[model samples]
Target chain A: MATRDELLACLAQFRDRCNADAQLRPMLADWERTILIRASDLPAEHLLIVRGGQVYLEPAAADGADLTVIAESGLLADLFAGRITPTEPYLNGSLRVLGTEEDIMRLDFISLMIWGE
Target chain B: MRYVVSVSLGSSKRDHEVTAAFLGEDFCIKRQGTDGDLARAEELIRELDGKVDAIGLGGIDVYLYAGGERYALRDGLRLLACAKLTPVVDGSGLKNTLERQAVRYLEEEEKLIGPGTKVLLVSAVDRFGMAEALAAAGCDLVCGDLMFAAGIPYPIRGLEELTRMAKKLLPEMTKMPFHMLYPTGKKQEEKAVTAAKFAQFFDEAAVIAGDFHFIRRYSPPRLDGKIILTNTVTAADVEELRAQGVKWLVTTTPELGGRSFGTNVLEAVMVTLLGKRWDEITAQDYTALLARLQLKPRIERLN
Candidate 1:
């Protein structure tokens, strides 16, 4: 289980990785969305707003985000770390992701660009 | 300094574009699809012939090889008739020539798919060049074309049968919509979560090979400790496959900006770079260019 600060750091790492990867930059060109991350064990402070080729951490989850992902802190860490896909946990109930197909695909693209197989 | 455009009867959603270097020269390559519209495809080839250096006919096969037998499709004939100034091919040239080399590169040279590997090739009809190459490499191949592509319950055994059947079916298939022949465009866009459907195949094989879209549309569950030997994977697809515990994702084509392409684009690339009329080119020329292009599968290892 990672600390709140560590989780915040993961979000930053994702943004930086996307910026550095030339292959990933093109996929992120049109990826402008508000993603809310809600961990069961942590408070609702981990909010990320993606726009203009960057992801920004917000103080609170936006009123109506383009995508909302809910999971426990440890599972959220696993999702961010590329240890597990959202589909696995989403099916098993460890994670719940709410978004249109496009929204989830956009986030998945970001996740792949950051840590790939 | 050359431009290569593909006139495809496929969908734009799956088509791709890239700018890359080959043999120390730079070129711009694009695949434009009519989404199964024949009139539009004809118009596209006519418009692009003079402007572009080469064109790849996509979605429909111009020719299929089965034990030295060439089965040409009527649809391909129509597309070929529309082109005059630029060299146009259906990527079969590369599929028949370089794909054999690529499979060898993966097994003996690159050692990506090693011997004793149990490979599940989705459909050899679409890529018989690769199918024949994999067979020649002595791989334990399981053909899924019948089950996966044709929606039949049986599995094909060898290259000869794959070629014979494709020769018989491809012409009839061309009469149907492009999406019906192979999943693409709106047909492929699904939100299904049925990993159980293809989990059996993923579990049995060391590598699931063939057209990525065909393999992906079936919704293969996470292939932890396994490999996906295919092409045209996006960044999002990698993320999903990684989460599924895929140890390696060996795309058959080199990618640009996280999007890999099919052989048609590369064949068009070959035409643009060679700067020769299509009829004048020969197998010898393709063999020489294969060494020159230096194009190989874009390998991604997760574990």
Candidate 2:
């Protein structure tokens, strides 16, 4: 069983991985919008994406935000770990897009870049 | 035609009798072993050899596997699997490990269905536990039901709340999870609303409730797509839904002890109607589906 802190650290690592990849440069432009991950029995929160030039952490939700990416923590871990396929959660309802479909699709591509299949 | 199988580790005739009464004549009640023993369990499963529609393993430790194989018990009956008989360990790492292992077994051994299948995982505790396990196991569209205290006591409200209260009352006390709880009269109504809400999120949704009244309250939205109902839904309810053009209908309550036991009949019904085997689905699939449906778990754990 992974602790909540451990799970949060894993998400941070995933964000770092996305920053190190150069091919993902194009999608980094729209990373400012908030990305909220809701999982387990916890509440939803903004995921902070720290960026320095092209190197960036994907934009997550702040105290208040326009976009939220809700999913079970385990699902997020699996998505980041490559145990399951990307876009699988959104399509299946495990990963829900509470924003507009377009915003959701944009984030979907970003997620693909971060997680890479 | 509903098929049922009761998987047990011991000759707990009471357990067999109870399961048989709930599942009816088409069901198989096989004895396995007690405690952490699987030798007899394996023998019983071998005898099943495709004769059963679904297998219900009595309360046994799912984590105590002798070799490479793990045991899979009925969905939502985690109390029996851990045999803790108290709520203190409900959210403990041990239970989580067992849930993950059970889900893994289901994924590796259970069969699959077409694109139309709907899977629901009902948890009396944190909805995320089952959701996370299922997702890790590769199930895509699993949904979950959270049990709540609908102002009732005993079997209706589920024992989770009392456990939480006990934890507060006895800060340093160790706790065991109990399965018995009070029933929520509004469970069916509340679940129906939940189903309708979930219909918007997933292509399919499975709403698990204790009684037929819940199914009756499940009036489909004006949306274009079709939704399936299961479990305690009777022949009359099926006729009603069919009249309304519900394309799929299946019953699974008999498999979960029976409709009388208030197990997740809707889940079984959805599995059968969608032609999905238990192993092919995971809690993540159901959680994701519910998330998409915007279907909140009925129960809320107090911090």
Candidate 3:
């Protein structure tokens, strides 16, 4: 199992690498929504958001978050590594969604990000 | 007996669909209301009564919707109506209900097999809770998992090797034949080749081919008085096997999510049907004894 800190580091690396792309830069710049990532071992207040030119990570709930993704940390790695799919995990009970389809579909970039190879 | 049971419940979001698979025929069994009403589901179940040996409930939501406030009573009656009622559980309140009822049924019903009977378990994936239940039931268990060589990838030739290894390893015990279970939407030919290899390893083997090609192409050189062939046997299959002087078929009910066999129900049903008296016989006698009694049809429902 990857630790919370390791996961955060991986996410940060992904953000840094992807942000360098000219096309990706515009998307990140305008990515102004709050996203709550609920993991089993982590505190519920661990929030990630992008506001203006800065990325924020703090122990506070982001108000009016656009999406909440619920899954175990290991599953997140598998999803990010292209070992499985969002639908597969959800059908197999490894992933659960409490939000609308739009909220879930917002993360469609995940497939491209992890499995572009 | 051919059963056409329908599982009906209240929740629309819940997965109440029934997955029925027999030899050469597998289909989704569901009750769609004309106006999406719950009564139609109930009527379907009533229509299927006394026709099928089992009516499998696919998920927890279906149970709640079907039983309503009186879900417990309805659930019990549902179990009694069919020879078997398999309720799928996936970390919900419904699982708790099924667990409670299953324990009671085991206590009241006769054990499926006699004490110390040896049984074999084979699967291509993880065998969760099955080995434990067999142990608890006092079965002398011999189990094996499929192994793939490095770089071989999924659906490898390991199933055949695994069967051979099992036969070699379990020389003293009677092998309960082999069954191949594949995921939905995957082709059965790959699995058939594996099953054929398994049958080749032993004289008397049963191959469960989910696809048509598998059912047709799988033919091992006749070991004559040694091997008996079955292609995805149903209730009718069991009757045919019994008529052919073959007895003691080892099978299990499908578990939730359609991955593995249901340990709780299989254990309870096995104990209730087989009894615990055969546990005392020697390995040789046990094998001979099993070859005499016709066993029940192994049923598995899709998630």
Candidate 4:
């Protein structure tokens, strides 16, 4: 039962951390696209737009997103918090990803910034 | 701190902790064992009754369901009598509720199974709730109760056909203990999976749904993109699946501490979190709690 505001803050932090990390910046530089993240249970969606080796978070949709991730907010938080594995929800069919294979690989790498494992 | 203990007739091999978080609450199920002695299982329940929040009776069932008819087990009644203060559940209470939610989530939400998607359910008699949900969702289903469970080699058409078959066989099946019906012995250890043998069903079906052990026994070398819908898997099991090129695996049961969990522990957790006795919680309550938790299966890509 994470509040909407807390989940939003976590998303912002992930975006900010991704922008700051040197290892992740190089990976983000390869893709200049918007990514839409929507929660299944809550009416909250965040768009991450990557441009010029930096990632930015926006509240609304943008043109030509790279990936669209649909999952519950709790699951998203748990993934970032390293409480649950990224592949667990995806494998269980709770997390849905509409992206190329390369994008999926890069997304997993970006998650490494938040969690080492 | 809420304490939930699972009293099991299984040996130390089956006894372990299950840690998980659901609906913002972190919970744990302490596995207590009796080394396969049924009397020890009752003794443990009697010992922990008032001290613990709830108790989960493992390796046995309260009832064997056959459509509308339910045959209650004498062992289950004796165990229930042993408990004085806390609610003790054999996990049958949540079968209809949790299992139905598990199937519907895969169809309506996850979109894994559609109108024409062929599904192979290994045994409808064992997982009746899941079978009912699959049929209600309108998937072309192959019920393998007669084939897999009874060694009859007859794949029933729909849930109705399987229900009729179960009505005939489940009474006899219930005469023996549930552990005899679903063994945790050497049969569960070694999986004699040959892709060539089940190629016909694997070729036609989009998903193969069944009990975990049943699926494990018949799993092929490669799954391609076929989704496995079952319960009770371990971390080692996932690695085995990944090595076999299983692109997606969906467990009906929620995973905890790097493995899928038993229904007994799951039902006990629900009873504790709901702050209600097992008898007080209804199927509707389970469905509502399932919605609140938004429990769905996980998938992996190895191919």
Candidate 5:
């Protein structure tokens, strides 16, 4: 499990990476999605909203998220920190995502863009 | 001279044109990719509807088969409906015949496949004929449809399970946007992440076969001495395979003008040569024509 501070820092770094990537911004230009992240080991929920090709992280949860990612805090931190690729965990069933296939692929693409895939 | 065009939803960087003679008939075959734009593909098809001898719909499949059942993709069907005069085909007709025969030729003539030969097929629903032939040739087959298509890591080991899963998923899966199921446009050009997560599958198999895009996008960087059996590869693709230390590259389609055109383009060629509507052609027609043309798989030893 990751501490609340660790999760926050991880997401902050993720946000910085996305905002700094000029190529990824244009790819997500028209793609706006609300992603809810839950740390299965933590009693906390967070929201990531993308609008106008920018990503904003909220400290609180929101309803009707376009996608939901559920995993242990350590795993979530690792994923956001680019310490590991998502395919292994997602395929092995360690990471669970609730959303349409397009959203899932987009999430993977975003990770691939920020990191190297 | 007959003009045949393939309108694709893939990247335009792979567009190609070649003029060749088949059975004494001159043909100018061309492929144009719309960079994943559906409207552009549809408009291109409409523009070529009455003008060309035949049109091939590439980068998308109008029908997917498994367990002897066929399911039509909504988007693919929409593109097919755009052609009112020229016969439009998605290459499913040839995939069912040509690919199967290609497998048999490789098994019987080349001895590439035999009993207990390990094979990793990226996706089987789109090329079930090849999948079935591989099984019939007694390969230890692993179908990676779920692993590659969906994000699941499960490797299906037999056709029975593949059929069961296809029946459960294809109904809804075929309705989704085609891009979600497979790479298209710029995504097709992107490199696979350098991860060993899926490398075990590649390392375990002596032969990897199926759709070229799937094989290219997900395969591990080094193949050393493995054989790749698939359809459609550009010249650049050939060089890449050679650089990866591949020993053999076998494309189901014959090479034309230094490019292995997709089944869609070749099927369009056959349709024009036969002067028959796409709907009126049968599997026997394709087999007989393939025999007449003596169409053989293009095999090259890269390493």
Candidate 6:
């Protein structure tokens, strides 16, 4: 399990990385959605609002989200912070992403852009 | 006659059945497409498991390789696991050995590719051997893995960059539904809107290579004087290529009837002829058999 502060810090790092990537913004130009991140091992939830090709973290409930990602808090932290690739946990059933396949693929591409490998 | 069936997730419109003999051994080879239905494909694999001498899983890859690293596709493995008695392959083995040999043959004998020849490989992770061969032969290579699969505009310029990109993305990408990565079923039949967008890559290259679908996906409307290096084209597909002004059509696999089959189906044929379990076979075995069969690239000048 990861503490709320720990997850927040990791997400903040992710936001900084995304902001630093000028190339990634154009890729997300038309993709605007609210993504809900819920921790499976804890009663914690966060919101990621994407508007105008920028991602913002909202420390709130999972309301009216277009996409939802459910995973352990530690896994979420690792994934958002670029410490681990999303493929292993996704395939092993530890990570569950519920949304349109196009959205999911876009999110994957975003991660790839932020982290080279 | 030995029976070999290719259970594909592609459109049934591409289904084919042929009777052929290899080195005095008669075989009945058939392809049954499931139109991108995973469960139906699994069921068909289960039904044909023990009944068929060998099975080939098409429109999906059990594994994708890049720079010595191999990633297994989740859905592909699921379909592969349905067969308990018969050996199943997705043609990665043939792509590695036979396609590499074909690239060499074209370069050495046909004088088609050589140093400074501009080549655009539609997707390389699925055909790493050909990518490597082209790179080694000094063709100015651009790999379209990113452009074709992810809708990304970035063109990977060299093998090093391609390998780097593959290492970063393939782990997760391969885990996703195989359809999202490659076109299947009706998706295969539709012309991609992005094809015209990426036509510059096609117009600049002297040779276009890789899976026929991927090449066709990002191909421009007119490919005047360009050589297409791929396999698994129907007669209609050939005409379409001719209409596009493709100068040369080179299929890595030999022509069976009027068309050449996908590597998966051809690999299943080889498995039946060798009478070997899938795991027991090696790349050398495939290469040796390719030599014995005297299978050469089906190269035709279309325009």
For model 2, the stretches where C-alpha displacement exceeds 4 angstroms are A1-12, A17-117, B1-78, B81-188, B191-229, B234-244, B252-303
Interface RMSD of 3: 19.6
DockQ per model, Cα: 0.01, 0.01, 0.03, 0.01, 0.07, 0.37
Clashing pairs in 5: A117-B192, A117-B193
Tens-digit lDDT string for candidate 4 (A1-117): 455676777777777777667645543553677888888888888887788778888886656577988888888766655565555466568888889644554565456434542
- State the lDDT of candidate 5 residue by residue for B185-302, as single tens digits: 9988886552255688989999999988888888888999999999789999999999999999999999999999999999999999888878899999999999999999999999
Residue range A41-100, candidate 5, lDDT tens digits: 998788888998999999765478999999999999999998976756776789999998
Per-residue lDDT for B67 in model 6? Answer: 88
lDDT of 2 by residue, B1-303 (tens): 445444433223223323332223333333232333444444554555455454444332222111122222222234233322111111122223333443443345432222323444332232233345454544443332211211111121223432333232211111111111112222333334334543433334432321234234434542122333223333444555556554434332223342221122223322333344454655555444333333211111111
Residue ranges of candidate 5 with Cα displaced over 4 Å: A1-117
Displacement of residue B69 (Cα, Å) in model 3 is 27
Cα lDDT, model 4, residue A99: 93
B247-277: candidate 6 lDDT, tens digit per residue:
9999998887788899998899898877888
lDDT of 2 at B110: 39
Q: What C-alpha lDDT values do all the predictions have? A: 0.70, 0.38, 0.35, 0.69, 0.88, 0.87
True contacts kept of 4: 0.00
* Candidate 3 lDDT, A57-83, residue by residue in tens: 554464756766677876765654455
Off by over 4 Å in 3: A1-117, B1-4, B7-55, B58-118, B123-130, B137-191, B200-235, B239-245, B250-303
Count of backbone collisions in candidate 1:
1
CAPRI quality level assigned to candidate 5 from its DockQ score: incorrect
| Model 5 chain B lDDT-worst window of ten | B190-199
**In model 6, where do residues sit more than 4 Å from their true spots?**
A1-8, A21-78, A83-99, A113-117
Model 3 steric clash total:
22
Cα misplacement distance, residue B190 of candidate 6 (Å): 1.0
Q: Assign candidate 3 its CAPRI class.
A: incorrect
Residue range B1-303, candidate 1, lDDT tens digits: 778887766667666677878887787777786776778888888888777788888766677556666766556777888878878888888777766776887787667676677888877766777787888888878787655654433456777666655554443444433443455445555523433555577578887887776677774655788878776576877888889888988877788766776677788888777778777778788888877776777777977
